[model samples]
Target: MPAPDLDLRLVRCFTTVAEHLHLGRAALALHTTQPALSRQISRLERQVGARLLDRSPRGTALTEAGRVFLPRALALLDSAAEAVAGARAVGRDRITVGYGVNLIVTPAVAELRRRHPGADVRARHVEWDRVRSSLLERRVDAVVARLPLDDDGLRVVVLREEPRALLVPTGHRLADRRSVTLDDVADEPMPRVPDERWNAFWRVDPRPGGGPAPDGPLVESAEDKAELVASGQAVAIVPGGEHLRRVRPGLVAVPLEGVEPSRVALATRAGERGPLVAEFRELAATHLVG
Candidate 1:
């Protein structure tokens, strides 16, 4: 016959009783009356369909079945305690915030630290290819990512709308132009993002004529893509965030015409209402403009 499905309460009672081998002492340890503990052990014995204890003048002794079950019962109770402890350890003041270099608002990150003094607030610079994966895989607790993300069990808070621009080397043909249209570089090769989640968005696919884009290097990080552009090997349409403009001075960003503005947002797993994630979302709300 199959073993009975015992609940945690029963397992805990059995472990306590087995530990002391005295009903009165075990009841005292468990803060229950002696009679109550006896009933609980009796119930457990009925469920298992085995005589677990031998009662005599000397007190209770484990029968063969009880001896065999004692070790497993203790193990179950120990595991439960550890699981509870592990869950509480999540409050150990550590959380990782992931973001693309361009999507992060510098001031907002500082504010998050100020708000969580005791928290080990850390940053994880995520690449465009891994934005959604990082959050889903628990690599980071929260993230600042671009829009057009699928609503697949995630929550997104719109922080700002960034104007899109094309990055070209200072010496490139379109570099000196005041501003250029997508058509001006229709056939120009741009770096490729092989990750399906990121490829279409970064590629700015469906050119003005609804056609495929010319391929360039298959890249991961924004820094790598910028290198390709700076070396005159490729061009990329990027968010015109102030930080990007300041860091990549070697590349001139010409505002692109007829392109959708990129929505920069804070994203986290759905149903995860942790305080760290909430605080970051609130901070983004006040500090960002979309």
Candidate 2:
């Protein structure tokens, strides 16, 4: 028998539903009504020839088939995004560079346009965890990512270095300190990153004199981390960016002493530097350095 034709839209609907686990919440997230979302998922179940989710009186739960298909579904979505980006790349003079909220790439983006004139240079504000994958998946040609990025198979150019700061609740013990050392918060649990590689980076691993960090609740975004700080659950060591300072008033960032500053860089896939990507990266480097 021939394989089923999976619709990307249905897959997206399924994934969003899977993430929320509530039809109304998922519909609200997808900007659609619950009935509309239900129709889409029903269509998806027919296409897959299996019930992916089991709706129960208590709530919705994924069926065994869904547990198996979730990861593959996400991978397929990433592949579809890459395909769309690839199609857009062909016969076009455009490049998309994703950056975190902390690192401001606007100045670099403006300079790239000044240098390239007619070529399209766009910027995307990506979440912290999605930075590296954005580059790898071709969703963006390049990214302005923080330092200690794995250099195994990627090209990275350091743009600038900035001090790291500790974000704590306004009323926390260390909030009034002029500056803090890693030793001061050595015992305080820090927010966690799901990816081990990022877990260390955000946590500022290798404490003073090479100590292990105390673990805290999982955090995946600035807002999430801020909540942890405000709730006195955890603290965050982050790049000292003005944007970070302005996002949450409940949290206060004090400069972290006795540690190296964070490095911001322009990263691209190794040996895959098309002209537009190269030009944008060069402009970013020169502008930031100058």
Candidate 3:
């Protein structure tokens, strides 16, 4: 026959009595009557085949067995409390996800809502670097970012890969090319975007020897960068994703010649949490494709 299980109620009853050294006081601590507490302790002692405490004229004192096992009982109580808190952390009325600094409002985000109508899906945009921190601190369960992140313990999935293009002014020499090489644009004027903002673009100094930096104007915001390219005053690098499909005639996109292209990936912490986190991961798998 299998041995009887260790009961939590017995641990609690023992701990209370151990601390108070009196049945009545321990019962009060547990919000139970003294007779009930006594019965619980008796059962615990019988299961262990040892007396936990000795009753004398003055009060109860810990027996040798109780002294030996008190620390383990205390550990059990602490573990129970922690287990409950961990479970509560994953439950929520609605799921909040970090959209990162990029767009998650595409068709896939819409589909997630349709699948989980009862769950409220709200979003907040943050810097790409902050995505992992947000997940670790519980600010958001998951985030969408350009993946292959350097986070020590995070998970990433390739969501989408769009062709990258060089955005040049209409009259620029490279603009006339059916396709242009990164070397052809080496001497062309370029503008700078915030390091944080341009992280998604695969345009990180693709030339050899850091050859002769272009003496170009610096521009903030992709819109201004696009405008600079359109005005023919400067050329900017751009990802030829759906976002760029709306380019006007003043701006022309030509593929980079002889250079390997790059793609974007979605990232999040590993392991399962709430339903929302799972849903977002699934959304990335379906929407983000190479």
Clashing pairs in 1: 161-290
Give the higher-TM-score candidate: 1 or 2. Answer: 2
Residue pairs whose backbone atoms clash in candidate 3 = 147-265, 159-288, 159-289, 160-288, 160-289
Q: Rate the local accuracy (lDDT) of all candidates.
A: 0.78, 0.82, 0.69
Per residue, candidate 2 scores C-alpha lDDT tens digits across 1-290 of 99899999999999999999999999999999998999999999999999999886687899999999999999999888778877878668888888876667888788878878898788888776666677776778788877766665678888888888899898989889988988899899998877777776668665556777897898777778878888888888988665345647778888888777788888888877588887777778777652
Instruction: Quote model 3's TM-score.
Output: 0.56
Give the per-residue lDDT digits (tens) of candidate 1, residues 101-180: 65555666688888778877788888755667777666777888777676577888887788778899988999888888
Candidate 2, lDDT over the whole model: 0.82
In order of appearance, the predictions have TM-scores of 0.64, 0.72, 0.56
**Considering every candidate listed, which one attains the maximal lDDT?**
2
Q: Cα deviation of 193 in candidate 1 (Å)?
A: 0.8
Off by over 4 Å in 2: 1-78, 241-247
Q: Write the per-residue lDDT of candidate 3 for residues 67-121, one digit (tens) a residue.
A: 9878988997887876664456667645556764345545556777888787767
